[model samples]
Target chain A: MSRLIIPLSAFFFFMAESTYADLFSGEHFNSSRIFVPHFLFIFILFLTIFGSTKYGIIYGFIFGFLFDVVYTEILGVYAFLFAFLALVVSRLMKLVHSNIFIAALISTAAIAALEILVYEANGLIKDTGMNFTEFATIRLLPTLLLNFAFIIILAFPIKRIIEKANFESD
Target chain B: MPQFFLNKRLIVLLVSIIILVALIGFSVREREKLSWPEQFLKDTTGFVQNIFHQPVQFVAGFVENVNDLQHTYQENKRLKTRLDEYVKLKTEVQELEKENVELRDILDKKESLRDFDPIQATIIARNPDMWHEKTIINRGKIHGVQKDMAVITSKGLIGKIKITTQFTSTVQLLSSMDPKNRISVGIYGKGTIYGFIEGFDQKERLLLMKKIPYDVKIKKGSEVVTSGLGGVFPRGLPVGKVEKVESDQYGLTQVAYVKPSAELYDLNHVIVVKRKISTTESSSGAGAEGDDL
Candidate 1:
């Protein structure tokens, strides 16, 4: 039962993200600009800061690969992005104190950085045909706000679960 | 072993970077055709998404139905009025269609308009990453769904299939602002004026129809439909209505902003149109000249 906790949690997180994505797939609030909630990344970030970075990176790789396979045209884009972001967040955690507010702030910054990386990577391969300003205003800002709200709502419960899992593993 | 030469973190970083670059390169090349492992993963995950999506969609649809109940009376009245007009128009359309078919038979035309079979599919999932603007439908190669086949809702044209796995396929929406997915369209009015829908304007929520001949008299609200000049999409499928038309910056050609007839935001069931192979071959020969523009 204890061993099943981590994998089950990760599976649930994956299901949650995909379900939410299906529910709010298209335009939101009748606005043309889309807001994609990075729920899975937020959970992975919580694990990295609170449970163990190594485990977080592993989960990131597995789930990111799944996301690539399920949702994206090209494979490895999300897998690579999520794992790389986990690494960055884990390293940053060592330098900064692990407080809820600070962690939320760090996660927001990390997600913003990740979004920019994805935008650049897509532009390199596919020529997204969107300029920097349009991307920043239309895509980046809304995504940040939506994810930040998600982090605030789920941060406490997620941190509690990771802490419990860490204690049990010990 | 020399400690300096065998630094663990440095070695890890180097290996991961190399792996990342290789992964990106591999995926870019494999975007169109998936290997066996990729296909296996896509099929399994697509199955799971379908499992999760169906239940949620049922609940969402139930709630929407409840909300719609209040307006049912008004909607019923409106539809009833339209039904009368529709019955009259239906006979007229059938008569005209029969006549058109007879004329084509006499002329020995090999291909007529609407020369394709539509495979119906429900949208299972949509990419959360908005930049991709892709939706996954529960139809694939097994169901005769292939890449570049046009997808449409009952109202109008929506998109084309971008990639297909065993059980699912990705649809690249018309709103995707990608230049490579341009659809050739023509305005249906007093005269036939053709152009290409190059990209979408998110701000105005309109499709940009570019490179129209400057002298063509395109009026606002004229119906725009596929010209059949594009080998992939059949001709006469309604695309949108022209909202505005203006000359290009260079003044060489005209550009029209079109409001897509399909409600792109609310997609559920869609039809994937598979063009007949012989027609595609024939059309490609004739459309080769127009395709250059």
Candidate 2:
């Protein structure tokens, strides 16, 4: 039953919950935006328990790659970074049995930071129109705010999901 | 011997930590190599998306219906008037069909246009970040939508098919503001204008076409269509119209702003061009990449 829920949630999160658009086009003033990444947050935790280190690594990779595939900015940079981030998050969670809220907040913040870093690095290497100072002020700051705000919203579900997994395991 | 055979919890913790470190190292070392596996994950996610989408779309349609009830009567009246116009148009079409058949009989030797085997699909998901980024459509390799095939709406160029699986395909929209959009656009009256189109900002949704030679006579409302230079898109599909033209500050070339004909935000359906892949094009790895599984 727990196995079924993880995959189902993973599927549902990617399919239904991730409906909001990212960056540049939408009005930035919508205060009621919910930052839940749905099954992705749960999926990360699921991978840590039942799957291998390889599964987490691939999860991170695909998380970022899917982002690039949909968004098409820095190519595979985000995909790679997400895969990397998931691996670390999974490891940390495995070590310390902490509150899911803090865990999710940290995970979201770390991934958001990593995403910004990759964007900066891509600009640096390619030397396109990306200005680091401008990116920080315009892009990263708002994104960080948005991502953390989302983390808070999703914390409840994260706790529920982790607890459910723990319950089933016990 | 007793020390070496430590606690089970410690062993699990140590093993988990080691796995974590290795995952970190692997992620950093080969970021570029992660595309294949990521593609696999996306494909699976897409399947899950398809199953869930039907119910979601049904609910959306229901909501739309409920919302439309307020305006439905008014819209119905308008549609009746439009339907009368369509009736007249249908009569005209019948006359034109007879004329077309006669013309076809006279001109017996028609060039074999490539068959466009299209699979009807729904737009399952769109990238939340970029409007012109990519769309995950509900048809894939099983439906014969190959990677690099051109996707278009009835209006104009949609984008190229980037990835495909058994049940879905992800498409990049032409509204990409990247510097790499070197599309061959043919203007009305004038033969051809070659330029790049990309996004500028949200407020003014304009595609900047770089470097129209200063000497060319391009007015405010010239029609632009794909020239089919690379055969990605068919010849003479309506791309957009020229918005404005100005000489570059550097004096090397002039630039024209093109307003895309397709209203991408409201897009519900799109047609994928199913041109035959040449032997050489198929051999080069485009064939193997976008499998749904």
Candidate 3:
């Protein structure tokens, strides 16, 4: 039962991502630009900060692969991005003390970095034809706001779960 | 401690980067087709998404319907007025359609205006990433959905099928400014002025129809529809209305910004049009170019 917690949580994240994806279709906004919520990444970042970096990377790789297969056209983009993000956040955690505030800040910055990296990589490959300023204003900003709200709502509960999972493993 | 020089993490990172690059390269080259593993994953995840999406969508629809209840009286009144006009126009259109068919039969024309079978599908999931502008529909290869087949709402054209699994397919929305996904469209007033819907202008929320002849006079509010010249999308599918026209950057041709009639963002149910152009008909039709009556 204890061992099942992590995988179950990962499944919850997947379900949450899809649920949020449906909820926030920008239907109320009536705008052309979309605001994609990276709820799964935020959950993985929580796992890295609280549980263990190695476990975080493992979860990141698995869930990111699932995300790529389901949401993206390319297979490796999200897998690489999520693992890289987990690795970066873990490294950054070494330099800074981890707390709800600092961890939230790090996660926000990491998500922004992830989105920018993806935007640039896609532009290089597919020539998505979106300029940087337009991307920043239309997609990146709204996405950050949406993820920040999720981080706030889920941060404490996720931190508690990760710590408990780590304790149980030990 | 030179043991630090043999960093295991660094080597793993380097190896993973190589693998990732190769994976991205392979996937990019094989964008049109999905590998079996990808298909399996997509189908499994699509099944999950369907389970999650349907209940949520039902609740959301219920809430929206409750919200719309206030406007129901006004909406019913307006719709009743439009229904009267629609009924009058329906008979006229039926008569014209029969006459047109008779005329086409007299001329021995094999192709009619709307010659495609439509597969109805409900959108199960949308990629929130925005950059992809993709929606996963419930129908796939089993339902005869193929790449490049047009997907439309009852209002207008929306997108085309990009990739398909056994039970699910991805639609590349017209709002996606992919250079390869250009749709051949024509303005349907006066003489037919043809152009390609090359890209979408995100700022203006309009599609950019480019390469129209400079001499062609495109009026604002003129209806734009698929010309069927590309042979992928059938003719007479409503695309949009021409919002504005401008001279090309080179001053050689005109470009029209079209506002698509379909509410692209809020798609629920869509029809996938499968064009069935026979090989013999195409081979014979190829010789008779510019003979459109």
Candidate 4:
């Protein structure tokens, strides 16, 4: 189970990086609709609940490091944020029944909101005066809607793969 | 009570093993060296990365193949007419070929040139966003391709090597769409006219010689060759030709329209000019004259 989870989580991270490149980095969209997909988020959440928190944090750090390298953003910022988010998401996993689609949608929306807040804060520090309201309505909102739509379509198949892999390991 | 199931001795043994490994790792890092174990791990990781990346490569290759098929269809239509022209010229070509052999012997007596170990590389991947940007060549450091090496096609100068590793290298094409690319150009049968070429817009086009002095007599059609002023590119290589010339406001300089000889969109075979490792004068000065393998 440990061996399978290690490689499987790495695969998920690589896949997410390759697909979400130039899409989720908040570079494409405005402040209103900056969003991220929740596949890795959900994976960390599921693993923390059913497997281990240490594994969750480890995988989160690795995933976020790769994200920082590819996205041309500050190092360790996303790593720390992802680790913190994974902990909170794991806690929420205890209350919700295992519905991957709903989990992915909720997580993506929350992460997107957090990302916008960070982006706005950075803008304020830099004195760029880039309007957050403009970005939120134009970029973040659209991305959130699009990501959720995609999650709804992909959740079933990805969830099945995760479950099958875990089951086979056992 | 939580840990009572495991033996204390076994726990101590595991902890001690981890401590020892940590000490070794710390020492290795402090020395800024890789231990045997670390080297093995690095090699293994690289091997795994190469294996996992096979699928990504396959997708890139498939895209290249589809793009090539489209280009082949276009070329086929043109080549059908060209084939008839070649047949008619065959008789003339034979007589010239014999004369060319005698001329070559005379030229050999006149001057000698150095030999190059040229290797042909196929471009594997290219960035779509930076359409006129750098491309990744399949040849890498292991393949005797070094940094600063010149890359050219049968037609003319393409670019040079910027970065290289064991399996791949990124080549900065001449038409990188960057303003920094100032090429020294000379119209055949005329004095060298130096001007910078750049990308005009999103149309995947070249903006050549935007502001040349209007006094310079440039015809509608003239071959532009590299001036070899830059240490990077060799002398007298075909870059492109003048298509149209327009005057800028005030008419201080003529904005000449130019098109590249090589169709970069459909580049297949490119030769990486391996600078002669030794100076034996074998096929030397090939860069200055007609293409010699």
Candidate 5:
């Protein structure tokens, strides 16, 4: 159950972000401002902070690969970035004071990095037509706002779950 | 900083970066279709997405109904006036269509570009990433939803099937910023002015139809429809109307901004148009030009 907990919840968040994408798709919803949900990545952040590092990184790789295969045309883009972000965040947490607010900041920054890296990776392959100003105004800001709200709601619960799971693994 | 590189973390990161570059390179290359393993993964994930999509779609449908209610009285009045006019136009269209069929019969023509078999599909998942405009439909190759087939909503043409797995296919919407997504379209009301819908204007949310001869005069609100010159999409599929027109760079030709007839934002059910002629015989590779793998 302990081992299954993380992967299981990761699957839930994976399903969640994709599913909830439909909710914002209404007639009145702002077509220009896009909200991309990274609930699974947020869960991974809590795990990196509260659970064992090895488990956190592994879950990141597994779920990241899943996201790439399912949602995106290209493979390994998210797989590499998700695990890389996990490792980076875990290392950074060691230096900074790790708290709910600080984790929110780190997670937001990590998401920004992830979005830009993916955009740059896309530009490397083909014509991504969108300029930087458009990307930041239309895509980046709304994504951060949505993920930050999710963090505020789910932070304590996710931290408690990861800590409990890690305790059981011991 | 040096201590950060002292451990196996650096090696893992470097090796993974190398692998990522290789994988990206491999995945980005042009290919006919997804592999069997990719097909399987997509199908399984599609199944999960379908389960989650329905309840949310139901709630959204409810919300849309509520929003629609506000304009119902005015819309009803307008539609009621149009209904009487529609009866006369319907008969005229029927007569013209009958005459067209008779002329084609005399010419010994069996199929027209307008003939297509529509495969109904429900959109199960939309790409959460804003970079690309793509939606996953619950129909695939098995259901006659082939790559490069025209996709439409009731309102008008929306997109083409970009990729097909075993049980799911991705519909690349007309709003996609890909330069290769050009479609041969003709504007009516002045004896059919021809041009190609080259790209979309991200800022204004209008499709850019270009390559019109410079001297040709185009009025705003002219009906633009597919010309059937593109082998994949049939003739006379309503694409949009000319919202505005301007000269291209160097003034060699004209560019018209067309507001797409279909509501691209909230897609639920769509039709996959498989043209009979394209299916019975090999296509001419004209429409296949937009296909990127």
Candidate 6:
């Protein structure tokens, strides 16, 4: 059941991120801050902490590639970043306790890196007119806040699920 | 250094970095059509996205309906007053259309720029990475939708078809920062004056229309529409109203800031305007990117 549950739920979280973004965007509620969903990314952070780093990295690469094809139309931007971030986070997991609070703090820092890297990569390729300050205030801040809120809500449940799965990397 | 060369993780990272650069470069190039693998992936995922979007749209529509319920009485009262005028104008339009067909018959003319078939499509998904203003809709090549066709909401023009798979197509909105994004526009006042929609002013939230001869007197609030001279869009599709005008930096031409009539946000449904008469590729200026109509 744990095996069935892990990958399946990660996929749900991935789909939910996009669907939730769709719900909040446009005429429904008008906010200057653009809230991007990093739900799947946060979930992968949890996977690295309590489940298996190996599984986390695999899932990250797959979903990130799907995200590119489905949404951005760019091929490798998300794939390379997601896998790279997963690797970095797994390395950090070696020194850290798996407590919810510590996990939350580390995830916040990871999310920040993710957002900045994406903004830089896209800006370089696309020539987006948004300046650094505008991106920080309008896009980056809200995305972090939104993903953190997602983390706060599901942090405990996800941790429990991953541990119960008892994933073996060695 | 020899030890580093033996590290598996380091080699993997270097390989991925090279691949990333190649992938981004390949995807960014201007291609006539997407490759087969891209088409297959898009169609399959578009199916899933369409499924995800439907429930959300239903709930949104329900809430909108509930909100509309509150305004029903006032709306009906206003619409009642307009009903008489609408009936009168409807007959006039019908009579003019009949006369137009008769005149065309006499001249043996077979086609007009205004002739188009509107295909209804639903929004399936939007660009998750909001760097580009783009949306996916549920009509594509199989549905007769093609690249560069004008897309409109009920309110007015919103965008043009960018890419079409077998089952879904991508629309690039007017607000995109793409330098190649341009549309031929006709500003209607006393006479129709032509220009191209150059770029969007993000701060002012208005479209920049440029290249009009400096001497043409354009009034504030004059309507701008697709001229069909663009070779893709049909004639007379409402685009926006000009809010302000200024001279370009070189002082050879005038620029107008247009506020689009259609709300490009929260798009649920759109019409793909497929022009009936095939137009030969013409160098009508900056608008026609596609070779065939």
Best by DockQ: 3
Which ranges in model 2 have alpha carbons more than 4 Å from their true place? A3-8, A22-80, A83-108, A124-146, A167-170, B1-43, B66-109, B112-117, B128-132, B177-180, B190-203, B275-293
Query: Deviation in angstroms for A33 in model 1?
Result: 2.5
Number of the top candidate by lDDT?
3
For residue B71, give model 1's deviation from the true position in Å. Answer: 2.1
Weakest lDDT window of 10 consecutive positions for candidate 3 chain B: B284-293
- Candidate 2 at A35: error in angstroms? 9.6
Docking class of 4: incorrect
Q: What TM-score does structure 6 among the candidates reach? A: 0.90
Which lDDT tens digits does candidate 3 get at residues B59-90? 87898889899999999999988998999999
lDDT (Cα, tens digit) per residue for candidate 3, span A1-170: 66788788887677667666655665568775557788889989998888888888989999998888788777688898899899889988988898789999999999999999999889878877679998998888988988999899989998887777764456
- Model 3 in CAPRI terms: which quality? medium
lDDT-wise, the better of 2 and 4 is: 2
Better candidate number, 1 or 4, judged by lDDT: 1
lDDT of 1 by residue, B1-293 (tens): 24434589678767876887787787766356677887887788778778877878898899889989999999999999899899999999999999998998999987755688989999877777766778888898898888788899999999988889889888889888576778888887777898999888877789999999988888899999997767678888889999999999999999999999997765789999877634455445564343321
Whichever of 5 and 6 has more TM-score, that candidate is 5
Poorest 10 consecutive residues by lDDT, candidate 5 chain A: A22-31
Better of 3 and 5 by DockQ: 3
Candidate 6, residues B169-216: lDDT per residue as tens digits? 999888888777888889767678999887787656689998899999
Residue A165 lDDT, candidate 3, scale 0-100? 76
Residue A14, model 2, lDDT: 52
Q: Give per-residue lDDT, candidate 6, residue B288.
A: 42
| CAPRI accuracy category, model 5 | medium
Clashes of each: 0, 13, 0, 18, 0, 0
How does chain A of every candidate compare to the true chain A by TM-score? 0.92, 0.65, 0.93, 0.68, 0.93, 0.92
- The parts of candidate 4 lying over 4 Å away from their true place are A5-155, A160-170, B1-77, B87-116, B122-135, B152-158, B173-192, B198-200, B203-225, B235-270, B275-293
With candidate 1 superimposed using the best TM-score fit, by how many Å does residue B276's alpha carbon deviate from the native?
Answer: 3.0
Query: How large is the C-alpha RMSD of every model relative to the true structure?
Result: 3.4, 7.9, 3.5, 11.5, 2.5, 3.1
